[model samples]
Target: MKLLRWTPLALALLAGAGTASAQDKPDPNLARNLAATCAGCHGTGGRTVPGSAVEPLAGADSAVLMQKLRDFRSGARPATIMHQISKGYTEAQLELIAAYFAARK
Candidate 1:
């Protein structure tokens, strides 16, 4: 019957959706992912990047980092690279990434 065939397909889709939602955890690996993107310029874990002017970020103050991020996102801070990347990221993701790095020590 048409109804029976559709019912199985609908159930399979629902099951797949539920599994995906379960996998969407808060991302404790925030530091790892963020570091990968930043390491090219900022160095890993606050180490100074070779031949780069960017400052270290591993043990920076959380408040300071948060403020800087806000500034970058709002055009208050004048950074070419950060402004571009930060613009596309959500506030929550920014906070998580900032906190992950700030709490490194």
Candidate 2:
């Protein structure tokens, strides 16, 4: 009888914990490491070199960055390399990469 009475309370607490964890900020190290692959072309922290044709990604909107990455992964946006490269990462990883670049100066 006691176990049954506590079950709902336990479930609610577990659910709340899950929600709180989900709301926590992502690990910066994870995002940085995942985004490292982009450094070769996008420059360190996604800041393109001066006079480069490549668009600077630093401080770009995360939504825009994520959309571009998704397009590359999906082949909806044609690219010389991004299409193939983007295919290597899962959508969640790509979002992390996007957030990493967006947060950069």
Best by lDDT: 2
Candidate 1's residue-wise lDDT over 14-100, tens digit each? Answer: 999999997887666765686567777777775675576898788888788889988988899999788888777788877777777
Residue 105 shift from truth in candidate 2, angstroms: 1.3
Candidate 2: lDDT of 34?
88
Clashes of each: 0, 0
Off by over 4 Å in 1: 20-24
Model 2 lDDT tens row, 10-96: 999999999999779666489889888888998988988999988889999999999998898888998999999998988889888
Show pairs that collide, candidate 2: none
Instruction: Give candidate 1's TM-score.
Output: 0.77
TM-score of each: 0.77, 0.72
Task: Give lDDT: candidate 1, residue 6.
Answer: 100
The most accurate candidate by TM-score is 1
